[model samples]
Target: MAARPDKLVIAISSRALFNLGESHRVFEEQGLQAFSRYQIERENDVLEKGDAFPLVEKLLKINELLGGEPRVEVILLSRNSADTGLRVFNSIEYYGLDITRAAFCNGESPYRYIGPFGCNLFLSADGVDVRRALDQGVAAATLVAGDSRKRRDDVLRFAFDGDAVIFSDEAERIYKREGLVAFTKAERASAQKPLGGGPFKGFLEALQKLQAEFELDSCPIRTALVTARSAPAHERVIRTLRAWDIRVDESVFLGGLPKGEFLRAFGADVFFDDQPAQCASAAEHVATGHVPHGIANVDA
Candidate 1:
């Protein structure tokens, strides 16, 4: 029999690890306020005294809740010099991280940022840069993890947006570059048509293949569509997903209202959208990924 593939591999910066507020309670009990300071400095600094233990514990818990299914590798990226890197490494070792993989990227490495190392989930504290990475095809998120119950295998909830995410942003782009009047007229004229595919298309196809590997009824991966498009415009969204043979278990048409509340209620492990406003709000309440669109030139 072929050997089973290695569990999912995650590469996280130290900042990403501590930014998780849900796990903050543990750190608070230990009398550490690492998050606030890190946010204020806007620099990747080493943990204060006794700060490393709680952060490492949170990482271990995240791994455990995922059934230890994903082997997590953390890379500490800081603006400090070699001495600071050595201190951070020493603290990590003192805290007992089974970290077989790590590296020290000079502060400049942030500018050379491509994407996370083969991780489906990339996170960043800087919104603009994160979005830029996403637009370039990196599935990136704000560096925040929530404290929620480990999701059951029974109801796997997946959610998506309409424009620029699940569907081509061409219309939105035209709308942005032109005017609302022209955009509405164009959308109405093409009401019976579908736009070109979006980034998630290939990933959705991979999901379909994975679904076929397991029986649908027993399949744990459930999907949903949560978008601002309402009514007449909604038809194309539904049809597009159907045409792709992808199944969404739950869907909501918010029509310009914020998606944070609905996304929180949905209890998603990871949510992806292209809008920074929506992603910022959702990231506060959930593991949110900002799908970057049209910001590639900035990174380039």
Candidate 2:
């Protein structure tokens, strides 16, 4: 059985939650000492919102919608040490975000603490941290920086890719290795065989439970499956969802088309895809999360 899904917890990197382009550049151009000094000196400078800021805001609002029971929590995970991360915490206070806990990892990756934190989802700017989190079977993605905005309604929209993200890359591996024809044949033959759940499955399950807290017509969260599969190739996807007993507000089978415009039309708060090309294309129009899993990300 899947884990309980009553509440949701998110682990987000400092760079993903707020704009750290300048600080990151310092670290890249100079070195750790220069980066530390830069952060410490600018401790009072409030950070700007990053690509995943809107999504994080919406996630926190769920607790407000639920009469402040704190059903959702956002934990900060950063590469900065406690001294340097003070600015980030100050920015959180300035923004009035409800985030309270954090892990200041000095100059190391902060992915190791996600398990202890019981995070349902992990979003980071570093692909390395995101991949490490996903490898531990936690839902993780690298937030793509872009100019995407939230929908007009209060609903939090989440869009996901099919293979290597929501579902295992079994079919994708077949397609990548043998070709589309063989993949189609394989999927059609195994349409009834449920695909293994990927890293995001648990997070999706928790999100569904959260949605159940509100009425369907007035729910504040909406989800979509925006994939590059269409027609006869879509059967296994439908069957897979049915097998999992999960519901998606929308499912678009693009069958190899670009996803940016479609995501824009859907007003997605964020879209997660395994392919960097797709993430780049989607980031052109919507907030995107690059899930570095499966065969498409073999080189990543």
**Best by the lDDT measure:** 2
The stretch of ten residues in a row with the least summed lDDT in candidate 2 is 1-10
Q: lDDT (CA) for every model shown?
A: 0.55, 0.90
True-vs-predicted CA distance for residue 239, candidate 1, Å: 2.3
C-alpha RMSD between model 1 and the true structure:
8.1
C-alpha TM-score for every candidate: 0.60, 0.96
| Tens digit per residue, CA lDDT, model 2, 146-219 | 86676767779999999999999989999999998998999989988889988788788889888888999989
lDDT of 1 by residue, 8-29 (tens): 2334455554433432443355
Number of the top candidate by TM-score?
2
Q: After superposition, how far is residue 247 of candidate 2 from its true place, in Å?
A: 0.6
TM-score of 2: 0.96
Candidate 2 Cα errors over 4 Å, as ranges: 1-5
In candidate 1, the residue pairs with backbone N, CA or C atoms under 3 Å apart (3 or more residues apart, or in different chains) clash, namely 135-292, 223-249
